[model samples]
Target: MRVAISRCLLGDNCRYNGKTKPNAAVIRSAKNVEVVPVCPESAGKLPIPRPAAEQRDGGVYMSDGTDVTRQFQAGACKEFDRVKKSGAPLAILKAKSPSCGSDLIYDGTYSGTLTAGDGVFTRLLKQEGITVATETMVEEMHPSVEHPVAIVLGTGLGSITDLVHVVRRIDYHDIEGFPDNAQPIEGHRFEAAIGALDGVPVIVYPGRIHLYRGYSAAEVTSLVRHAFRLGCRDIIFAGATGAIPGKVEKGLGILTDQINLTGRNPLAEWEGLRDVESPFVDMNDLYSPYMSSIARGVAKDQNITIGAGVFAGVLGPSFETRAEVSALRQLGVSYVGMSTVNEVIMAHALGMHVLGLTLAANYSGGCDVDHQSVLATAKRYEDDFQRWVRGIVHLL
Candidate 1:
């Protein structure tokens, strides 16, 4: 694959500050393909360590109020021509700059606020019908569809493994960058399986660690990050929770929304995630409407009742007390659990379409229950759970 890239991203000191914005992700891709590095500002005769520039009033201007619109435009044309002559079909541009920004740039006010817009050179390339993406998005690009759907099975809901034609199995200890203490549950395997479920490629994590297990929030949902690296654009999270009694019953439900009562967020680890453009990813309609609708229809067709409700995530190895349940009921939580929320946060941060499903293992408010009973109930509905996953897989 021949691709165009911003020179600064390729480690050239071409920025106004004379510093390169080196991204290991772009460099990795460059190793496997031809990378045509272009620095539009330098091409326009702007010297390294020159005045900083930004887009304002639809024109390029220096920080000292000097208008460089003509020079920027001229360089944009030249860079476009170079990319055209190279015959590159794809490009990875720096995300927030005056000359090469692809997704967002500083607001004209120069207050460090960001707005959606393209850089001068990016606009020229778009006019030529070239596909342009940010450097952060480069890691997910692949020549073939290897990872399509990601499923994280919670507690004892991992029976989906039996139906999948196994392709690859990677253990947690073997996964790169996971915390040292990140181990799977005693009975459930600590591994990820890449396989085809009813002919649809999917990656399944049979068991997930929890916040109560002395793991950091990022450590709890590290599998989500791995899934993005595997090129999965759509992810499904299936977990077990306790029902809120009247609002929802003990069976299955689709998570319409979630309240992060765990007091810990996976995105708080953003300072360590230099590969992403930003960690404050939007959570609007966080659960994919299209996937949820398909799941709803599948449940009905398979004679399985699927309810929709808000889920409240708590930090717990201990079950919720009667008082805690009442407080959650006041907040309109139909189900409550300990896992799934952190993974959901990480999944959305990576721009993947998310689908969340929960099995109501018991009445959370005041039910006399034990973990053994919960696991037994989950195993009991294994057949129905598999049917629902298969029906949804067919749609994907």
Candidate 2:
């Protein structure tokens, strides 16, 4: 894979301060790939040790109030052309510069305030449909994991297991804490496979136990514990969800964060609490933004329409009512489902990086919501879901 990166991140002294902001993590990630170094300011013929610039009022301006929009655009165009010709699908740029910031750039006030917008060069690359990430995002992409990635499939979404090359299979009954007489409902399976998907090591559970099924939080999360014991440090939780009316479309959605309305946590009075100093695990970034970014890139590469939003996990063996859906929408939820909340909580407590993928099988509060329809919808999109999961695994 070829990647375009900010020249300064590769240790070039090309910033306005004439100093390099070299990043070891970025360099390490680029070591094996063909790297195209880009310095938009330098390409614009801006001298070293020049005044710093920020984006404001639709133009680039120096700290001293001098307009440099033309030079910045000139440099961005020059570097963008080079990157375009290189055919690099990905670009890792500086986080907050007027020229290369991918996510947020400094506000024009020169007061160090960040506004949500891309830099000049980044905007050009995005316009051309290239995947743009920052140095921090790159770091998240390469987490330290020596074990296989774990995957837990939810109701009607177990077809992903068909694509795995199974090395071994285990019955869920043998897993500790699993119910003795556990039987999968229609559209789910009770088996686990240790295998490789597209040559990527993985341990896949074809179905999961949910809290609504008279299972304790600990019992519902047994698969997570087993995966952790097997040395898996990264896990993907894929499920079928109901789209929150106008908040999310009925297709694929990547979980950016979650609201646990299930009212039960896996770590509540569990023996696992003895191992950690505090039971209060920071829920921030619980869904792993790094993996989410990779998922977005995969969706873009494959031409799949996917939305990123918050998931509301409820305790449900039944679909939500109209009033319930309204409450969820007010909470900023895009997708709503039952299984992933406890599993995700347990996964995070175990220090595993998580990536959540949801298929919006139906619109919440729709009069036609039914299990049969959800299964039918899952069947319709199974091929795309498999492809998306495989693409993300390949990148990992």
Candidate 3:
């Protein structure tokens, strides 16, 4: 594969001060794959010893108050065309340059304050659908175990955390915009677990927020986004769901699709989602067929019967009424729940492969099941769930 790299990273003296920022790892990587070196500032005809520029208000400027926005844009355009014509699918860029920065840049105040913004060339490449990342994020986009699977443990399913040989832990409090005052549910855990599952790197979120808890869609699915940010590519959601009778049994299941009766979309409320090309992400194979196939094979190896069905997601702290259950049944929903789908949508939006494994805690119609019942069912299937997850991660 051909990859676009910042010219400076390849030891080119292309900076405003004519200094090159060479990266040894990036240079080593070039030995195996074709590297397309790019210097947007140089291409834009800026002098070798030109004034250092920073991104300000979506434009580039010099320290002496010269608004060289057009020069940077011209450089970006020229470099973008060259990179595009190279057919490079990936680009490793400088972290903070006004022309090559992928994620952060100077605030244009020339006071050394940093802010979230893309560089001129980087944004152009991304807008053209090329995968752009700063050198720091290169490892995540192409991990040694590509597509390392992640598990999002649902309510009563947090016990699965014990299965991980933890390498690192990130507290929910450490994440920005996370709610500190959200009411604590009995089975929920707020920390993140990062470790090896069956000798493979896997991340586990023991708790998640819900819409009924007054969280916006973004809040509810924050863990999913966090997992993706931390290098997990495949997400497996193990949650307690109510079974629709005569469809899937009161045990484990693999999701085929989902009905978002919850009437809310996490992507709808999310702004500045820069990584995605557009918010209209396709859900055609929303539930990953390849991951599901691995899960089904694993279940068969353990003599476990697995059912596949459409999941119905609703907004509720309350159980569905009988009439509501009947309506859901008519709509061909095989499992009903208050969570999972919104997170699934957000994961899909981020282009991560998804696998849904649900535990049918009870029959939805009139079981009158409480949270305790859900906990009990998860306990009963703990061993089986662990084995299934281990096998899937192994295959990934």
Candidate 4:
């Protein structure tokens, strides 16, 4: 894959301080791939050890109150043209930079405050339909993967399996760690399919056991371990969710991050796994931003209106109370669901890339919410969800 990257991330001393922000992970990921190094500031003819600048008031400026927006824009345009001509689909930029930040950058006071916004070059690349990521997202990009992607569906979303061209099937009872006597819950299945969806290799688990079903964290996450053991390195967790009123509209959404309100960690519960180097796993980027970007890009191309939001995973066979719903909304949660948290935690601990997709089947704290209604609502989005998943797999 050809990727455009900030020159400084590859150890180029092109910053205003005449120093490089070398990242080992980014460098390692760039191996064997076509990399186009770019530095907007240097391309603008800004000298080494030049005045440090920040974006403020819709413009770039030096700390001493000198405007440099023109130079930044010029440099961004120059690099944008070059990257576009290279036909690179992705760009890995330096985070929190004045010209390269993709998600957040300095608030322009020179006080080290950060704000949510893209940098100059990032904006240009994005406008041209190029996917932009940061050094922090490199690990999730995995230049290539020979293993099949895993798809674990949660309540009422099992229809996605119907689109797969199956090569084989496995009974849940035969899968190690899966409860032998466990029965499938309403709207769930108890089988796994090894198949290809849209010509992409994949393993599909049509349903999962949840915490409220009296399953241990390890039991709930057995699918994750099984997927990893089956030579899968990427997993997609899709489920039904309750949309918080006014926070997210009822439909399909992508999980940006998650709050594990279920209060359980699979690393602490799964003691049989002896391969874990450490139980102390970093949760940052657990819901892969790189994959999420791909999902978003597919959504745009397919004309599917998918919202992005934070998910709160709770311990539940029962629906949330009004007060609980209010608390979750106050916590900035856009969707509330009963699954995916433990599964995601286990996937991350096992060194797998995760992408969480959700179906907002109902409104949280609604009086008429039930499993039947949730399933019915999910059916309304079945076509779009299938198309969305297929597009994502094709891209992967």
Against the true structure, what is each candidate's TM-score? 0.63, 0.73, 0.63, 0.72
Report, for all candidates in order, the number of backbone clashes.
0, 0, 0, 0
The collision pairs in model 2 are none
Off by over 4 Å in 3: 1-147, 274-277
- Candidate 1 lDDT at 344 equals 92
lDDT of each: 0.81, 0.87, 0.80, 0.87
lDDT score, candidate 2, position 304: 88
Highest-scoring model, TM-score: 2
Q: Candidate 2: what lDDT?
A: 0.87
lDDT score of residue 34 within candidate 1: 65
RMSD of each: 12.4, 6.4, 12.1, 7.9
Model 2, position 278, has a per-residue lDDT of 75
**TM-score ranking, best first:** 2, 4, 1, 3
* Error of model 2, residue 368, in angstroms: 1.5
Among residues 3 or more apart in sequence or in different chains, the pairs in candidate 3 whose N, CA or C atoms overlap within 3 Å are none
Tens digits of per-residue lDDT for model 4 on 82-111? 999988778889999999998899999899
Q: What is candidate 1's lDDT per residue for 1-396, written digit by digit as tens? A: 467889888899988899998988778667745678898888888767877788999898888898999888888889999999987766778888877787698776777888999899988887786767777555443212565688899988988877878978988777655776665664356778887887778888888888897888988878888888898988999999999877888988899889999999988874456776665678886886546755775776689987789999999989998889889889999999999888898888778878899888899966557788788988888888889988876654
lDDT per residue, candidate 3, 1-396, as tens digits?
467888888899988898888876567656645678888888889998988888776667899889999999998999899888987666778888888776688888878888888888888987886767666544333324445557888878888788888978988877665677765487779888887776777788888888887999888887887777767777889888999987778988999899998999988877747556766878887986546755775676678877889999999989999999889989999999999999999898888878899989899976659999888888898888787777666644
Q: Looking at model 1, which ten-residue stretch has the lowest summed lDDT?
A: 136-145
lDDT of 2 by residue, 1-396 (tens): 567989899999999999999998888866756789999999999878988899999999999888999999999999999999998778889999998886789988888999999999999998997877788766654533348889999878898888989989999999988899778887789999888898788889989878888898999999999999988888999998999999989989899899999989889946879887877888887987657766886787788899878999999888899999999999999999988988998999888889999999999999877888889998999888999999887776
